[model samples]
Target chain A: MIAPVRVGQAVRLAEWAPGAPIELSEIPANSAKEFILPASETIGRYDRDGARFTMRETTPEGPRTVLLGVRPCEAAGLAIVDAVFNWDSRDEFYDARRAATTVVATACAQADADCFCTSVGGAPGATRGADVMLRLADGGRQFIVESLSARGEELLRSAHGVTEGEAAADPLADVPVRFSHERVTGWLAGQFDSPRWQEFSLACLGCAACAYLCPTCHCFDIQDESTRTAGVRYRNWDACGLGLFTQHTSGHNPRADQMARWRQRVMHKFSYYPEKFGMLACTGCGRCARMCPAGMAISDTCRAIDAEESSPG
Target chain B: MSIAEARDEAPGVRTFRLTFTDEPARARFFGQYRVGMFGLYGLPGEGESTFCVASPPTRTEYIECTFRRAGRVTTALQDRGVGESITFRGPYGNSFPVDAWRGRNVLFVAGGIALPPVRSVIWNILDRRPEFGDVTIVYGARAVADLVYKHELADWQQRGDVRLVTTVDPGGETADWKGQVGFVPAVLEQAAPSAGNCVAVVCGPPVMIKFTLPVLSKLGFAAGDIYTTLENRMKCGLGKCGRCNVGSAYVCKDGPVFTLEQLHRLPSGDM
Candidate 1:
């Protein structure tokens, strides 16, 4: 499983079939220009000029991939997706993408005002979702690529550019993450009765931006689209925050109010997910906190619920 | 939860039971397998129109569940035949604690198809007949011809330990309509069951449960003392899917059969 870096060229992923560096942006563009990539490699499809552009793999199915130089939060987002994707009825499409992609994450040394990964349960260098995490170690020179998953180890073994070395045994011990998952989960579990959901829900724009931006939010809906003769049933991600997400065919909506919808978000991650899967759905990556214009911090809300629960009655 | 097992029940209904199917291992968890949070003996696909175990949970000769052709999951279940498969996750909802009711009078009120869940309670009660006080069953339906498990009810009526009261609406469709008429609530009110030391179990459509609770109340039944089953859209049964929420409580996890006090505390009105 171990290989040495070759001379005079950057590491080549088995994905490229030949040696060359394909930046993250180039892959999507390459898929649009050439239809040579594997069908499953097409993570998503874009329709333009009656043509489709797909970012995909070299084969229909393959081992893990080296998605080099991905942002740490983006890497963290992948962990969030695991909750809903693997939930009761597994989504093959999402599962396939997750299986194919091997993230070598680079931590964010500089976090913005919106960054609250630590607040929720992640840090600027959060590795909750990363298979192999690449930190700006040695002052941003040789990346401190630590393997967080067995898949991470396999990808690092295949990495052609770097020298393999023993990982720092305590990667996050000294790293200032500023969040406690135990506290977050403890708070989330008892938060089912909290009133903060009402106020937080009011602040929500209900545009489904939080679900779309977050790496972990994986709400999807299945639709049977068809022509006169043929129909294909495809499932696309859906968000509970959407006004019409839970609307029945007869116009009956269970989460008619923002409060109920907001409650579902917290419950899905903390309560419903844990009760079913025995783990929290959220990695506390805080992507929703960073991207939302409403200035809502999911961490703060969860912590508030936890604090309320622990306070003397 | 994919279908691990399937079979056809009486008439048009189908009973699909799932244990666990660990893919990498290429084996299934059946009967007594307790995978994760579920007991691993119930069918999950038949969405949460909750039904009690017609057969025993521990008696897993065939993880028994008998569902009629009703709403969504039942409709799908009805179409399924023996050996046909469907997705499911659990026997996740709450069950009647039969052991606790030992030596206590158990009153089962079944209104129409509601007997399926009540049957489990009744069967368990009768199975250990020596453990309980007198058993009284008051069952009614829209018409005499539509009563489920008719022959069984008639047999139970003849038995010495069980007192079976059968009734139908005013318009009697069957020739054997000697029993009382009017609704189950009206009949229960007329019978005047004493409130002391007895558990009254009721299950039916939403309207029936709503009206029957008052009758139990009139008989001096406390909210905590009264027990009934609930029905809702339960896709996962494992409480993962959001459909079965009655507040923070997922009915599939908290209950199909719950005390009245528990129902009153549910945050979401979906109950």
Candidate 2:
């Protein structure tokens, strides 16, 4: 099973052995995006012979795997990216990985200040993207397993447990709704030129940590790495916060400043993504807030936008 | 694809005439190719750079791409020999609706490096000349040296079927310069091609476009009749990399081509 475990000071998803200690107090620092859209992957490779070259596409052989202890938000992230990768022309690389993987989400039994799953139409025990759900029961000694899909039922059949009994799961985490996603999205529709974006992004150092840690920030950059005669075209994770994310070769930048970049980050998730994908890009996972070096929080920004929207002008 | 011919357009800018190695692929590409569609041209080690397929699909023997030597990929591309291979992923994005503009005069307003995209449409109309009305090209560059497709510009000038008004920016003209000298917007306004029964295609730097749109509007060109292509930075060119979106529209999928009316609907600040 691939579950979250402590490595030095951070919790990351790694192969788990039976009876190994698992970190369940907090979500993994790295989201489940790594399992599907890897940080760097070769999309194509080419070989050159003087002036002529031959190219071949690198097909992804997606191995069967299970996400053992991911949270609902983490599981939902894969589904959000699924819409984009499959839209219009299907990205076979992402599709292959997504099809072969099964999600086993554990319902949150505790909530921290950095968690806000309830605000974005997700909840502690939501089964939106999970194939199987594991709820804690009997004071963390037992799990009330619930199969949500055919994959979940198949997964349960491979388990060692023989007992067929029902048990009441522990109380789910008490996460308060920080802001209305609808209100924030609606307010953002009319606030593209608002000075508040500059205010919200003043402390931002243009570091893309928020995007890297985010489960659903799926922007990527494609480049070639090679050694003269041969090369591999690779797609790597990229973010809107970076200065060069939208810069043209002619030195013109559409989103010229950090304020515009910050606004894009927010508007893409809240308004544009929803208008296109029919779902918010954000899952209300507070990893961006939790990991930001400048102490910026998307939730706080949304809250402030909502406050402004609710106030008299 | 192999580079069949390479020509220097201006300093730091070049044009490559590429031919597909596979005959079936060539047939398939031309089958789907349209004016205003772009391609991703690349070298094995330098990655891909996006640009318009400069030559029109009407000329199916070869595809031509003009690019300024900027960034790694284009630099490597310009350095390659004539017979060298380059990867091409192409004919992507929405195209100029030339079929819809049949029997209407076509006015092309282009500035500097942006002439390539408009050139495709011009050739498309010229190739099907009987289907279209009068053709007028108002092409401008920052300087006489900066003008691309000098040979093609001379050809358009000689052709009685096409009315071509070439211009360089003020103070950029040479001693032998016969063309007008002014900014593109001012030149376009001065040229004053009849907007009635005409479809205007404009492509240029953002500053040129911003000022030119107003001139186009004042020339009795309706928002719907005026078209321009967006030059948003993109990767993948398949709408998945997520960088090329302006508001909800994926420039790779929804358009690299859009009408002035459509551009007005999008967030102008983002563009």
Candidate 3:
């Protein structure tokens, strides 16, 4: 079985050993973002032979593999990031990597306080980014598998799994909807100058742990790294929570304070992205809320925004 | 595809006239570009940098870009020779509505290296001079050497239809300096062009714009009649990189050009 194996402090996707059982009960701390959009990769390299310079695009190197036991929320978050990477100018590296990977999502059986996929048009059994979905059987000894995409049907055709008689019963976890997504988006539209942003973001340490761990946060910076003879241009993750995210070279920062940065994060997800792409930038994975050191919860943030009375413009 | 000509416009700033290696690339660029649109220029290993297509849309033979040697890509661009090749991706973003301003007076104000974006519109208007009314240009820089487009500035001064007022900061004038000696906003107020039936296009560093906008307001320039460009940090010029944003608007997509009224609608204290 392919499953997440505990590696030191973090859980990583790996092959399950014979003696070691697959861990699918708890959600892994890390999502499958690296598998699709890697942490770092050289997009292209340039070589200068005397006065003649030649450049070549780097071909992606990885075998096509299926990822098993991804949570439903994490699976949905992948689709959110997919929209950004494929918006207008498609990222070749991400497209290549995504083409080589297939996701098999598992319905969440347990959830903590941070789980709120229901509020953002997601559910425990949501099959948004998953090719195949797996649910536990009534006796808990086996998994009832279902194919969601054409690729999943191909994989299922060759599998040795038992019967395909009748459809299985509902196999979704219980997650409460904390706030209305439409209400949150409407609230965010008018909160550009709200003092609540400063109040809500005062404790934010600008750690950017929320952005780094989030599955749908796709802001990136491109730069060139050079040796004495050759150089390569690469793209890496950039966090907007930092003050320097929108700083101009002339020492003028547009998003100057932590509150402005925090506001960008929320607005980009609920308002800006929705206006542009016709979809929310979040999939309610709740990783940002779970990993935040400041006790900041996106669920709580949305709820608070929903509760605020709108003032005349 | 290659730099046909390069000129040092100011200290740390240079302008390069690029000609495509292939006939199709040259044809395509000239076929569909307008005033105030920008291009992403760089070498493959150096990554792309965004800047205006500096050359006017009227001169469609070759494209030119003026940039200051500040960042990594600009420095790499500075080292390139005439025969070297660089990648280009654009004529992206919306263009200025110069056609709509026909029969209206045009006021162009620029500062320092921010001249490139405005220079595109300036030349666009000048090419069709008879289509517009009185044209006034008020430009300033930190010093005499910091002024860009010097050749064009000299030509503007000689034109019968154009009124050009050049300036340098108080201490930036040389012995032979013949223009006004003050900041751009102060000089703009002194050489105040009438705001009636005119569209004022301004581009500069943030501080210059912050001060100049109020001066234009006091001079009776309507907020809808004032235009500026946001040269924010960008990566993918296609609005996907998610960096060049001030509010809900993506500068790479929704603008590089915006009216003061549109700017007012954006989130305050961000820009």
Candidate that would win on DockQ: 2
TM-score of 3: 0.91
Which of 1 and 3 is the better model by lDDT? 3
State the displacement of the C-alpha of residue A301, model 2, in Å, after optimal TM-score superposition: 0.2
**Ranking of models by TM-score:** 2, 3, 1
lDDT of 3 at B240: 67
Q: Name the best candidate (by TM-score).
A: 2
Give the poorly placed runs of model 2, Cα more than 4 Å off: none
* Per-residue alpha-carbon lDDT of candidate 1 for residues A1-313, written as tens digits (9 for 90 to 100): 1111222343212244345443422101111100112221222222222111121232233444555555555565566556544644565555665677777665655544444555545565667666777665554346666788898888778778787674342233222344455665676555555677777678888877777655556444433333333333333556778876665433557677888888888777776566655655665445577667787767767666656656788
The candidates' DockQ values read: 0.06, 0.80, 0.57
Q: Which CAPRI quality tier does the interface of model 1 achieve?
A: incorrect
lDDT of each prediction vs. the true structure? Answer: 0.58, 0.90, 0.84
Please provide, for model 3 over A122-207, each residue's C-alpha lDDT reduced to its tens digit, 9 standing for 90 to 100. 89878889999988776566788889898898888888865766554545678998888898898877778888998878878998
Clash number for each model: 17, 0, 0
**Across residues B45-129, which tens digit of lDDT does each residue of candidate 3 receive?**
5677889988887987788999999877789888887877777888888889999999999999999999999998998899999
Q: Cα RMSD to native, each candidate?
A: 10.0, 1.3, 2.9
